[model samples]
Target: MTEHVLYGGKGGVGKTTMAAATGLASAKRGERTLVVSTDPAHSLSDSFELALDGEPSAVRENLFAVEIDPESRADRYQSIVSAIASDLRAVGISLSEDEVERLFGSGIPAGGDEAAALDVLAEYVDSGDWGRIVFDTAPTGHTLRLLELPDVLDAALETTDSVRGQLHRMATSTRSMLMGPAAYFGREGGEDELAELKARMERAREVLRDPERTAFRAVLIPERMAIAETERLVERLHEVEMPVETLVVNKVLEDVDEGCSRCRTRRDQHRKRLAEIHETFPAFEIVTVPDETGEVHGVESLERIAERLEL
Candidate 1:
């Protein structure tokens, strides 16, 4: 079974940084790890300072990363819908090209890439090659919708039960005419499409909810916004019954003992919150990663992150 580690929180709270560090930790343990970014504004590549926009690249011996292509995903989705439209026409249900495209595009964001990327993700997990996978999801709202998509879709399917059954029968018969009935239902069709999507979402959620299989590591700085976001995230995940596992305090002031005004004030703020984080949430464990001397970029800098995490 593959493990999924999700890093999530409000935007710009070091969620991606924590995700990259987690992957590095797993890789150093000699486990094969694949880290993916589901954010439309992907910065996993930028954090590592490596090129990964369209395909997976071997960042290290056991580490791989990919930033999927949204345009390609949308194009492939269009093709699937076009074929579906043609099949509907054969059954005397005339569907316009624009209408078909609109149907596929409906409910999804303006960009089809996330859905496309999700399509690929379902396949990768099925492949069962990697030991671990880390997903750097988009900010809170978008990520929640993605998590809830399957339930929404299943409800829709139930509401359109008769139409779906007819569509499936029509699709099966059309495929039966050529290359036997096997290929058509197996490839792309109404019932199969619905089942595949439902299964995929549930699988991701299973891993997401499993504490051992996946962990949602929320990152927070000492500032007001980051701390406030962390509190909200904690409550939200609890409502979903998938409470966060770890809290990472990134960019802490180094050398609290040093006699410096800026460091002293920042250190004081962090110390206060650290106490609150521990006392308020006794079940949760917190990890503090101090602000390093310089920027954290590239493998060496990221390695320091693993060091902080003690992996």
Candidate 2:
């Protein structure tokens, strides 16, 4: 059984750290794990202290990582559209050059970084190649948009298909007039490709919505802006019935440099904000990662953070 864990929060928060930590923890438990960064501004490669590409690379025992390049994935997406056009051409009436350009223009019709990332994600989820997949998602807004992508894509595809159906009728009639009754025109593989694409989308939707297989972990710091963003994110997730069961309160000032007045003030502020978090999201299981002396990166630091999570 494949289990997916996604960490999402406001930008500049510790989502990448938490995601890396969680991936380490899951791998420590002997699960084959892959930590993938879906953020267009990816930091997973830095976190792992290993150069990574769009393809997964081994980071440690049982652990792998990938930082998706949205542009590269968008190119792959465009290729799929082009392939579909080729498949259409195989049977009979080929689309006009303008039609081909329109279909493949700008990649997905309702496309953006999030859509590109989700297309990569959908591929991974459909593959079922890893036991555990941990996602370091984009900021709150982009992550939410990615989660909502399937519905948007479904609607867009439906509209496109309807238009194509009408065009198909028109094109077939034209071919009949030109080639007579025994014309060699058919939909050929176009419908099959469309069905395959739809199936892939539906499969991605199932994997994301399955609570038993998918979990969302929100990472935030004890700051006003982070708290506000997280609250809004939770509300949006509730609206969509996407499950977010945990809150990781990262960068909590614990055992800070006592002599520093700034540290002291921030620590005090953290405590109060933490109280608000407890009050605001009472249902969430709260976990804490205390502020480290230096930046947390690389496998060792991520492992330490994972230990702090006490998972």
Candidate 3:
């Protein structure tokens, strides 16, 4: 079975770094790993020092990376919706071109990006290609929405299918009465398409909630606001039954010079916040990553972070 690891938290909390490092670590352990950036604002390529696209590309031996473009995914999702509308029209449902345009003219619906990301994620999970897959998710709010979307979308799809069936039956009855005899235009293709999407969403939800196969790691800085946000995130995760077991406290001031009072004071504040983090999430295994000398980019830096991650 393939294992999944997702790193998520507030924006600029080094989630991409943690995810990249974890991928490197997994690959070093001889597992074929793919690091995926599901964030709309992708920084995985910058972190890896290589250009990436929707398709997975080789990063190093046993390691591959990809960045899911939200815009492209959203466009694809819109196309799928348009296909369903076309199918309805083919089945004798009265949908004017103007009405269809009105319904889908808007670029992307609310949560469309997340829904598309979920679809892409399900495809990757079903592929059974990588030994392990690590995800660098979006910020806390967007990541939470992504995790919650499967259920919301499933319900919406169910409702849509039911309504479509009812409308089809009504259309068939009316046409038969008017024309004396009318052939049934069954929409098996559209139904199958919807069914497949529902199944994919359900599978993704299962993978997310399964602890043995999936791990949700929250990454944050040693700050009060970040800690509070993480606490809320963990609570929501627990509510959704996708509990987080690991917390990464990144960019902690590790070694303050004795002579520098300013550095020492900042380190002291970090310690206080660290203690609070432990108190708040006592069950979580917290990993502290010290502030590096410079920007954390490139494979070499990621390797160092991987060591700190102890993956």
Candidate 4:
């Protein structure tokens, strides 16, 4: 079974940096690792200082990376819908070309960006090409929605039961002449495709909730707003029974000069927040990454931070 590590938090809290580092660490341990960005902004490539596209590209001996492009994913989703439309047309459903195109262009069933990103994630996990996969996710709200999407999808599929009934009525209306009987129940029709999609979505949901197969790492800075947001997120996840195994307190200030009053004040504030963090997340294993002097772009700097991940 493949192991998945997902790094998620509020935006600008170093999630991409931590994800890249963790992937690098896993690769160094001889695991074939792929670090993927689900954020529409796509910063994983910049973190490695390497060019990447929709598909995974080798970044090191055992590391690969991809920046999932939303446009590309939308196009792929459209194609799938188009195929479904064709199947419907063969069964004599009077759907115009524009109708099919309109359906394709509409947003994905549940929370467009997160749903599409999770679909891609499910594909990667099913492929089994990597021993470990690290996801650099979107901001907290979007990532949480992605985690909660399985329930939404289950409900959506249930709503589609009416559509399936309509399709069956259409089949009987046409006497099933052009469309084979096998098309009514199997892969030749839309029903089986929707069922397969649901199965894949459920599989991804299981992988995310399984502690042994997956780890959700929440990253945050030592600041009031970040801490508050993280606390809320942890509570929400707890309500859903989704486990967060680690809390990464990123960009923590270390060794501030007492002569510099500004640095000392900021350090003191960080200490208070840090104490609150320890109290708030007593069950979580906390990891801290000190604020670096320079920008942490490129593989060497990322690897340095990855060393601190202790994975």
Clashing pairs in 3: none
- Candidate 2: where are CA atoms >4 Å away? 79-104, 184-189, 257-261
- Supply the TM-score for candidate 3: 0.92
Candidate achieving higher lDDT, 1 or 4: 4
Better of 2 and 3 by TM-score: 3
Scored by CA lDDT, what does every candidate get? 0.71, 0.80, 0.85, 0.82
Q: CA RMSD for every model?
A: 4.6, 3.2, 2.4, 3.3
Per-model TM against the reference = 0.82, 0.88, 0.92, 0.88
For model 4, residues 21-120, the per-residue Cα lDDT tens digits are: 9999999999999998989888888899999998999999999999876666564345446555655774666688778657655434437777777777
* Tens-place lDDT digits, model 3, residues 204-240: 9999998888999999999999999999999999999
Return the candidate ranking by lDDT, descending.
Answer: 3, 4, 2, 1
Cα RMSD, model 1: 4.6
Q: Which candidate wins on TM-score?
A: 3
User: For model 1, how does the per-residue alpha-carbon lDDT over 116-203 read when each residue is reduced to its tens digit?
Assistant: 5556667678888888888887888766665555455456545544565577677677768865846464444455555565676566
Question: On a 0 to 100 scale, what is the lDDT of residue 240 in model 3?
Answer: 90
Clashes of 4: 0
Tens-digit lDDT track of model 2 for 201-310: 76767778888988888899999888998999988987777888889999888777789999899889999999999999998999988887777888888888988764
Top of the candidates by lDDT: 3
